[model samples]
Target: MRTLRMILLAGMAASALTAPSAGAAEVTALDLGAATAARLAMGHVRFANGHDYNATVGFGSGAFHRPGDPPGTLYAVTDRGPNIDCAEIGAVVGMSAEALCAGDTAAKVFPFPAFTPTIYTLSIGDAGVEIVDALPIKTRSGRPITGLPNPLTLTDTEGAFDADGRPLTPDASGLDVEAVARAADGSFWVAEEYGPSIVHIADDGRVLVRYVPQGLEKDLAAADYTVKGTLPAILAKRKLNRGIESLGLSADGRTLYAALQSPLVNPDTAAYKTSRAVRLLKIDAATGEALNEYVYPEDEAASFTADAKAGKVKQSDVKISELVVVGQDKLVVLERISKTTKFHLVELGAGASDLLGSPWDDPKTSPSLEATPDLAAKGVIPLSKTLMLTAEGGPFPEKIESIALLDESTLVVISDNDFAITGDQTKVVRIALDKPWN
Candidate 1:
């Protein structure tokens, strides 16, 4: 595999990867390697915590699309820092939850409790990729926020330890920021996996407000920042680690669209795994209120990683990593299930039914949205989707987690490098769409 990686790198140096769009049209690509001083800083963190930095520079999880920026300039975000497998954890498996919080932490990953999610301003071109500037997300009081998980009382969570196997407590301000969008006022809206919440960050990175599910609004209100439970209450059923994963701002910047990573744990895990209907929430950014919800149905599997398709893995493999608003009411959604990543042009037509807090949410409904024999027959018109491109047979990165608009005619993509684990490298790919509006 290392040799293949070397050969791949050699080939990459000679030519960038290219893949076909629909029809005879092909989306040409320009690949840029990202190098930053941040890797050296993380190297120290790795040695101290026994957590190796997989990639050279690790800021490649979520993406923030900034329109009208200087050409070749784009923004991307990093999620909670590098994580390790359970077997890689440095502690005993069955330690008491209480004991896990009092002592020092020995967690193989997250040993540095102070690791913060970072936003990167990337300048990408044929020359290469470089960080123009970086911003560290912080709390309302101007304190840096960690990437650690929130406490279990508020939601499902995991305990933390240090490299030597000691206990650590949860931090309320911790955020696993996945999707980001820049607001007109220079502030930002970030979608977090923890609260499955939408957080407002001042231009300087202070958390201004957070909107989460209704039931937990009060639970997290007393934190050192503002918290509101304004998203649809049904969102409370969001599956673990599979909350809002992608965010986009409407052209006018008045509306925010958030895509759930996978099906919610509404009826049960079994139902969620096989369910195809994932939810997309349209929210009023100013009020932090859910204006409407649309469904993106995962079609019957015609293609999937053999393992995932063979029943060796859970059926909840399909996920939405990032979505961008291209046309007036049309969204360019990046959908993937394992090695196959496809871009779909979805339109939020006004004729579609609003599924927020609808009967489809009732656990008792015989035909769950996932099981609905025919959504259209029941007057439930899903957001119209048109195939744009598929990377199944293309030269694309493994985890293209974020996408942004470089201009009305171009799109840019970034992949989470997992710090380069398994030889995956962070790359910036410039895609000139066949149709900018598509």
Candidate 2:
């Protein structure tokens, strides 16, 4: 029996490696233990031509030079299929290739057709996670939309609509949208790097409200209020501080955790060094007001940066990507660099509280933070069970972009394919979270 099982397992891995391109990969029979969820719900931004680009690049292929010699393609595994319908949105018309390619010619000549947003539902079956349906989402104005690399398109245009077919404007300037999170109520919040930093959108893609970090009203007030001139100009003047990139709400749906995508630069410094501190700000879910800011310890920041600079490690940036609430006051953060993805369990200390004054807010009462030096001192506690998913299956290259928990014990991971048309592959994979991280 052991011999037979070994053969079957070897064959499965082999088949997976050489599987012909067809529809998306599917799983029909998964033997997950009781600790894991039976049905995993997953969401991602997939391209029609089976290519995915980094949210940063917007439209073009992500190609760069390694430290040594020739430049190579930055292979992303997150772009999978169920192509976008660009015509549904205005993306197909009057669309400039500026966002798609790094070079002018590359942007003008990229071959993929324009597309609009379509939700593809995947079911875990005997085969694996497979696409069950592709449903088109309509805006309040009755037009279809797709995601683009530009923040204005991703946040301001893709998911929004006015009553009379005009775009619902955001309140603050330079609100370049980077990522999005859906709420339990079906409403969505977009994380923008530029200010009017965050925008709240209704299900029909209407801009219901906007959230700006405190202390920026004067700068915004000085600008003419037109999204084009005001938002980007202010963002540029402020040295392009891309505020928030990742966002997650509390399990109870009252508190929000927003992660800054990059370090803030000190204008006084001659050369840009990684900010000594990276912050995870807590906010009131109801009002989108700032509750508290948690800064990473200096030692931890130094260690992360050293690893990246040494070339011994790849993901040196240590940007926080996504946050998940695990227990009452405990949260899990997905921190990624160019080459590493780490899952951290953070306990915001007691006295660290939320807007509603829930017990979970009092860091003094919570063990994760109260016993520690300060709420910010606890730094990110490394969970023993870590999964080192590679860019490729083993030696192959893949770039993981986004992750979502289908339940407590199952994780859905998506890779970005960097929109390469040849010599690249996109993947969406699932793994058990119950496995030992240590």
Candidate with best TM-score: 1
C-alpha lDDT of all candidate models, in order = 0.70, 0.38
Error of 1 at 305 (Å): 6.6
How many angstroms is residue 106 displaced in model 2 relative to the true structure, after the best TM-score fit?
A: 15
How far is each candidate from the true structure, as Cα RMSD in Å? 5.2, 13.9
TM-score against truth, every candidate: 0.85, 0.52
Candidate 2, residues 1-438: lDDT per residue as tens digits?
011111121123422221111111222113222222122212233334333332221111111111222121111111111222223222432332232322132112223223333333344433444444333333334444333223332222222221122233332222344445556676655565555355565666555555664444443452222122212111121113235656666665677666665444323222113343444566776777666655432223324432455565422245655555555546555555544445565666544323223332342343422123343454433122222222223222234445555554444555444433232333444544423221
Best by lDDT: 1
Task: Name model 1 segments beyond 4 Å from true.
Answer: 1-10, 13-41, 44-57, 87-108, 305-314, 362-367, 371-379, 421-423
